[model samples]
Target chain A: MANIKIIQGDFQQRLKLQFAPGIKAGFPSPADDYSHETLDFNRDLILNPEATFYGKVEGDSMIEAGICDGDIAVIDRSIEPRDGDVVVGYINDEFTIKYLDLRHRKDGYIELRPANNDFKPIRIREDDDFEVWGVVVWTIKNWRKY
Target chain B: MYGIIDCDNCYVSCERVFRPDLKDKPVVVLSNNDGCVVARSNEAKKMGIKAGTPYFQLAEQFPNQKIAVFSSNYELYGELTGRVVEIIRQEAPAYFRYSIDECFVCFDGFADTNLKEWGENLHKRILRSVGMPVSIGIAPTKTLAKMASHFAKKYEGYRHCCMIDTDEKRIKALKLYPIGEVWGIGRRYAARLEALGVKTAFDLANHNETWVKATFNNIVIERTWRELNGIDCVPNEEMAKKKSICTSRSFNGMITDLDGLRTHVSNHAARCAEKLRQQGTVATIVGVFLNTNAFREDLPQRCSFQETLLTNPSNSTITIVKAANEVLQKLYRQGYHYKKAGVIVMGIGPDSPYQPDLFDFNAEQFEKMKRLDAVVDRINKVNGTASIVLGSQQYTRKNGKGKADVVARSARRDACQSKNAIKQDFKSKNPTTRWSDIITLK
Candidate 1:
């Protein structure tokens, strides 16, 4: 089946009838702790002076490396990823995170390995088919008192 | 000595990876079958939400409190746990991953140094790097270390690590603790221990080893006794090689048709085989089963089990799946609304086991299988699972029911199939954040 989507204003009246009270109350506003500072959307997008951009982590491939889903990642595009350094790479436009393998193959190729054994290692053909977006400089993860 | 380092409230910690706001919230992770609670955060425990309590039951009990209920996001937990293990390996002298949320570390010698300090440093490093809170316990034996770790979990003053190097500390802690709460003492064993007047760790430890072993039916109780006395009884674990692997689940809708049941079994077999190849293991026996709901009184449930032995142990998905299907056929009977179907692989060993029937015509089939497995594995590794899949899983819920590539691609497939795929590792105070991929469905 195709992805499910409903047109805006398509069910405004029906939704209003079903959830009018909830609509008036609005979502239980998250506490100040849950509310993140709003990003300056109007600010001109700019990479760091040293070629870094903070991107939100979307998947768990790098969770083993301590970079978890939804965590903010510090990506340094300028610094070449060394062995064991986690990197965000683009393979055919799909973003992936893995440890960069510097071991030279017979054809002098490189492979990206996920920290978790559950994920298979990715071998990059010597032919320039992949792009290393940036090396991971740091990870911002959640911390809370027990 | 060998020690198991386990995280407290691992799932909740993973969730905190992103939503730091959920720190100290009543959080619980549901079991694989969406059946009951498996892991609970400290806050959840404080709320009296017991582990294995049914989610629906808990919801009824505490409908007002905003308890965070989450499905098991193993992908994220596995990833986070991996990071923790890697960091431990880098810091510790030697270590082996004991389970998804546990590891065994060898901490010997250096009495002059503070073991608690080492543990604090390790915990801080993991939190800084992986974003998870881990409790460490140092004792002379692995079993005692496990107990110490358990003590560390409940006591906030221990600074996330507990060591019971002396008998006084062990005895003091044990007097107040229930005997059933001890590791390796399950409900039945704990009841028996209590009946025998062994009501606490100290009580159990004080018992004669021979009597305890005789009462417990094995050497496990004796080992526990020694561990309590600070005698190193548990051996250092090299690696736990899986003897068998299984894949099973209760259907969202009960399946009564044999064909539908077969398809479900096939799906599980395919998954089990994927796990097999991932672990470099092969199976010699395939077991299949189908059963009706045991709780439902309206229908009488019939259950059947059958197994097939292979001439050659193989990691080939097709080989095992085909065998599992045959077993399913033998076991599946009509007129019964089967609530569950499952596949079990036994006699598992290294993948390169020799084939006894080398001259069989299927030798050519094996060659094709080798190539096919490699190609499928490669493509799925990149594009995600069901980038390719056996056509059999596509039939009607039985005739391969629920087989449409669409439903499979959208929600259910993402929930069921992606588990063994897109593996990522990380650790966090919030288990939900780590397993966000698996929870994305919710």
Candidate 2:
């Protein structure tokens, strides 16, 4: 019963943060004028605004892939899911984040491999209702905010 | 060539995006107020469920079958439609959104390219991007393109894209396409054409142009005949400004009180004004109508309508709501259970550089109102609808109370909140538009 709700991202009010030069532990270098260029996070991260969707991770099955519980997964439907790519897939009408394995695809079946060793690889039968919803482009975890 | 990309079972497809479990199951989307079936999945269609069939009839029709039913969620469908349109805009050189579920694209420069392959890629791109299946039909004319789209949807062999590029293919396609199924031809014209031995599109194309023109005496049918013959008679439809705008809805339950009716009327009026501003148009006339349920024979039925002409055209929500409220007051009748109310703004024209009123001219007041409307529209657009509405439109419902008591409490609350209060019970979430409804995994 996990329904993915997609909200449109506001691109007009983009925040551009200045990338200040890093300070070394050995010595602190003078701030360079070249480091004043600001970066637009939305432009850098989101390749396709219309096709990109954000979903929160629920289970720990994909913890090995750095997509832990409560992490936000950026799924891009525009990008084709390649073999071994982390993908958000719909199986039996439920969404699951897993590694897509195409090695055994020629045998007329696909495999959804969970990142965590605790979970077993799911063998997708030809008769099973399944689809690759999108490729997980990025994952954002709230390290210290929470 | 013009290509039409139409989402297959649009409303059903939208619902499936959220509830994939509905796949391979009989699903039906009900119309407003959960009255009748507005859309049905392929399985539902196979089960003999028809569009506009009353929701109550489903049980009688399929006694033992499991069926998934959903009320019309326009907010979700509208957002998904926008996403689909955005994808189309990026893929096609130029496009016209024909409707919520369909778009017409022109392939002007890519004449020598592999059109069939291009169509397939477009189909796959939309499906992958939006999770909605679309059928594409490419032809020399819009009418023919529409006909080709029908074939693309009907036959699986087409692989969701059917292109009629050559004259031979055009003739063959037209031969199989019925006159009734042609783009612009309605039932009346279809019957008349069939009586005149025009059973198929091929037959219509074979007739003499002069004879067809003299027989039908309609420019639209003439254009269709020309289009069937591989001539692009219908140009790309331009987005034209509307002459009038209306916002109306049938309530979930009947209301007998005048204040209750006023709430819905003001809401409709505000929507009409918002639409006018969206289109950069102003209305010179405002109309309001209220009607009792026609199906309730046991109750006394009454219907009334009234309109007011403004001295100066305006797109202001306050002005429109005031006019609508005045008309609603005039149309209101006691001892009637009103089932529906509506507001319409007519005499629409360009909003800018309007002629001021001769007797009553107030520039400062108009400026202030315009600024207020702009702020309200911006807030509502960014925060989802009803972030701010007319004070008269506020309504409240008491929780944990009996039906009769709840109604009485709501009436009292409405009277007190009419000055200024915000109360809403929007059961359906605007997931795409509202930040609060965004999905969170638990």
Candidate 3:
């Protein structure tokens, strides 16, 4: 079975890292401000803390969308799932990581397009069991781990 | 206007979220221990499958129909409910979670925006996000919003979102709505109202307020009547901290041993303490109760209840579980087959700046317990339920043999490590909360 590990990210103890404005590879500049305002990753990445969830991508269906296998997809249910939005959706009782195509102008139907050309797009009928689980707000790619 | 979003067939919907094939089918969710039908889908209701019908009687009720029956999976339901609540929290300016399946939202600043359209969007969002069908009712009062939600669910013309905006619409909706179906009006009041010629919500609303108050002599009824008349009498801040929290469940089978009963009681106590901490409250009294199978006429009947008052109010699971076990010892009967057990924490108060006992206060132990609880709660929050449980709660028959064996220091560690300690055979994967249970695409 393909596994999608969901780890609840802690928002309480947020790490605020100080970043130099422009790091010069040649030499360290003394003119640069020593004490820069700390940037909170939780605040910058997560728009809605309560509604946000982390789902580990299991398949390469949305590889073209930068959500490759083993990547962590940050889903935000609070955000409206719009056309062209990459969404975690349920189709025929199974969940899929796909891009929602609502521009077809079809009544009571929408297309779930897989990013990889190898996979065919799923045309969901109104009567068919389908649901857009949440909109993928951010994708964290693990270059080393994968 | 106030808007109330209520999930249609909440438990069944929660079940259907994982099993889409059960959609439009005769599906019913059984209560704990696979007892009775606690929740039924619309199709099941249409097929005359009544709620509260015993699971065993399903075959007799609908012999030929292939009914999809599932044991109640509260972990999944709770996680999904939290997700829905989170969405509502972000959408509404101000909101109150009235129940697991219902929430009351105030659109205070969105008066200029079309409320009907807004309600529709809210419904669609929830349906899409959580796979739970919710009906939205927008009205001037919470009670009316509830009534409007009933109409939204019952009739397809409303398109899952009904708004009672104008006086004309209110009057029309209320006239069609029976007095019994009104928010706070129960069967007793409905019968009384009917006798007094108040057959519908419209009739009750049109009645003289002073006369109705005098007749009922009840504040809630008076408020309901006022609310029906478009006066928002019910306070929006109705979600108050609970005074008492009780956690109880029926066993899968009758537990004859005291150790088994202790394990269940400790679990309940731990849950109660966790709840108290969630609300930032401490309980002064801890109560435990155990009862033999009431349904079995052949077995000996025994039921016992015991409670103890603590010198210091505490929300620590260790303290509560220790106290609960003491009460459980008092309640436990050797021969009786105990089918159910419960733990109730009462006389709850705010936990901030706890007043220590003058003579018997252990500052070091109190701080230690607080830290212990916080760590356990945090771990459990991130890593599913019961990842780390009290050793006392893990004393099962298969592993520890009995309470006497579990009391041994060496045996306690072994019991805690046992996989069969916490029974969760009926528990569904907590898709939203647990890492392992998250839906995977292949």
Candidate 4:
């Protein structure tokens, strides 16, 4: 039988040592063909070339879109989001999905308005700070039966 | 062109695959044992059958009509759907399951390839391989594709394939189809739009975006309007994980005994905990509830709910069910035939982000118990559900005989062989087990 003992001393060093070939047996490794770290590391490589990876969408404002509480959206980096496009954008390190309100303000400001009435439009603080991850080329929603 | 393929008469098709004798017949799958019409075939609908019509009502309407009705066979439907989607995934570079019956496939930049031919191939493949007929709709936008798919399903001679990519084709299709038939427009919204003189898809498309947005300020509605105009406003997501995991089911019969209630609650808690584990989240609160059939006035009715906080957030079934039992007792009252007993685990957080409890038991006993529970769960999952259950469940089921008998008559007409029912019927009355006897006590 294989030893299933968990060792949690100096995790960084232990993880680094385990990366070496012919490392000693018995570590807190997940039970899979590939280690947890290996899968996390390969996530970048496994991404669809045509698709852009936008992290989790936060808020129930767009629940009618079937994009509920916590859902990760994929946007096509190539497609230019037109009017009414569901775009993933960054506003002060926070990511959100909303209809692109391209109408520039008279005061030299741009805003992205949420579909739900509960949330306010995210006003562009600085032109340099705002970065659109990608235009949402398609939306994949959940099929919850219950 | 984007293609949307929808399964035709899904529940009836699923049933027909198993019972081939019912092919091309007017079949209607009932919600639960001739309760109401949940799924009906094209043949049944032509015979003036309606969805959600009470089975008794349908029987009255079609006294001479041959209607092969069957209870909803979820296992077969789920299994067949898995097979169909597998065939789809094998065919398309990218695919999205819009619903159980419908899936959208990307044929992006198919400049030279014959799109209609491709759709026909997929339709025939699904029909031949899975024993189910599917209609395909191809259009410039997903919304139009969905609309066209519905038309293809309703109409004959479309040869299971319909396309509306060009303006001429789209106009012809829209003129013939109703405005409410569009993917996102529902009855109330359609009525409002119709009140505004927008009676068809062509009229809706002819209206400016400003007016549409003014009427429907929600973002999804605006996207729907855009999609109607041939713009892909909604993007595709590769991985969409579940937000909340719930495990609940109405019991075959009402359970009055406290032990039986606890057993059902434990079972639900365990199932929900497993779901949480599958999603890589740990629930901090377990909500347990019990309710009686509100329609039944013969018995005293009661409904109660209790949410218990966990010391350490976990997805372990043992830990969750222990919490569920505590809530079950607090909610349980005397003399109520409970139709449903359920547990909903919420306040989910990432497993790695949890702060470990200080001054918690690190005793060897606790560690051993966890390891044992893990082993049991692994065995149960691999073998079958309830292949190995807690002793409490066995004791609880023993005490539930009186309540089970009340609903046993209605349950037995299904012509299904439930393993537990056989075991329950065979067991000698009042048979008991002694713990010491296992060791050959003399």
The iRMS of the candidates, in order, is 12.2, 2.6, 3.1, 25.9
Best by TM-score: 2
RMSD of each: 20.6, 7.4, 6.6, 23.4
Clashes of each: 41, 0, 0, 7
Q: For model 2, what fraction of the real interface contacts is kept?
A: 0.45
Off by over 4 Å in 4: A1-146, B32-35, B53-61, B109-112, B171-206, B242-248, B251-262, B268-382, B389-395, B398-442
Candidate 2 per-residue C-alpha lDDT over B196-247 given as tens digits, one digit per residue, 9 for 90 to 100: 9889999999999999989989998998999988888776633346667888
TM-scores of the models, in the order given = 0.67, 0.82, 0.78, 0.57
Better of 1 and 4 by DockQ: 1
Model 1 interface DockQ: 0.02
Best-first order by TM-score: 2, 3, 1, 4
**lDDT of model 2 at residue B9?**
91
lDDT tens string, model 3, B208-232?
8889878999988999989999998
Candidate 1 lDDT tens digits, B1-442 = 5456787688778766545446667878777656678888888888999988976798798888988777777666766787788778877877877777888788776443677788888777676555678988887777677877887877889888888767787788767678887776778878887888888988988777777767776666777788777787666532455668888877765777665666677779888888888878888899998888988889987878889998788888798889998888778777888777789999988877565575553777788998899898888766655567775564342223254643534433453443222122222233223332321200
User: 2 or 4: which has the higher DockQ?
Assistant: 2
Candidate 1 local distance difference test against the native: 0.70
- How should the candidates be ordered by DockQ, best one leading? 2, 3, 1, 4
TM-score of 2: 0.82
Reference-based lDDT, residue B424, model 2: 27
Which 10 consecutive residues of model 3 chain B have the lowest summed lDDT?
B416-425
Candidate 3 or 2, higher TM-score? 2
